[model samples]
Target: MHVRHWENSGGNIWDKYTVKMFPQEYRDIDKIYEQALLVSNYADNAIALAEKLEKAILSLEEQPYRGAERKYGFYAFKGYRQLTVENYIIIYEVFENEKVVAVVTVKYGKSEF
Candidate 1:
């Protein structure tokens, strides 16, 4: 992954972290997309939802701390954070020393899983 660096108006360099998704996260997202297609029976809607989720996840590359600390359920004591995209909650953790944001999981907000 390529880390992006940008300059602010004041000529300050802003470092963008690299974003990585766990192998399981990829499988989970694929399953979510498949289930969405099955439930809605609409390819377009499923595609749109997948794209939106991807966009939100990618945004972490530039703003890794944008999501609030996970203080409620599952992984709450593990120092994980969460970013919500539509009905899905993206769980992630930031490794500031390595300048990387790792996505741990993605779960439907309404589901207990």
Candidate 2:
């Protein structure tokens, strides 16, 4: 699976935190980055996750769950879903025909609405 982030996703993630913690947060962000890398060697693990997530979404739509769930503080639009991965939540969308997932945000845990 290949993951793709929206232009401002990374910035949105960082913006939720204090500027000073950016350095330490980078260290934390590295873990997910590694998890994504382990899944696929591609330079952008976020893309990998997006692709993986798209597959899951397709499965979900095909199977038809009781309902679709949204995480707290997630803003909704026509074609996307956002969720937390540990402390940070990445916003993403699934494109059915293309089987593509686009990540729109990569924010920290302490973010508030």
TM-score of each: 0.84, 0.35
Off by over 4 Å in 2: 1-74
18-100 per-residue lDDT for model 2 (tens digits): 11112433444566567667767776666655554434333323332212333456555445565544445544455544534
Model 1: residues with Cα > 4 Å off, grouped in runs: 1-14
- Backbone clashes in model 2, listed as residue pairs: 2-47, 2-48, 3-46, 3-47, 3-48, 4-47, 13-106, 13-107
Candidate 1 residue-wise lDDT at 36? 94
Model 2: lDDT of residue 87: 49
Q: What lDDT does the true structure give each of the candidates?
A: 0.83, 0.44
Candidate no. 2 TM-score:
0.35
TM-score of 1: 0.84
Q: Can you give the lDDT of residue 59 in candidate 2?
A: 37
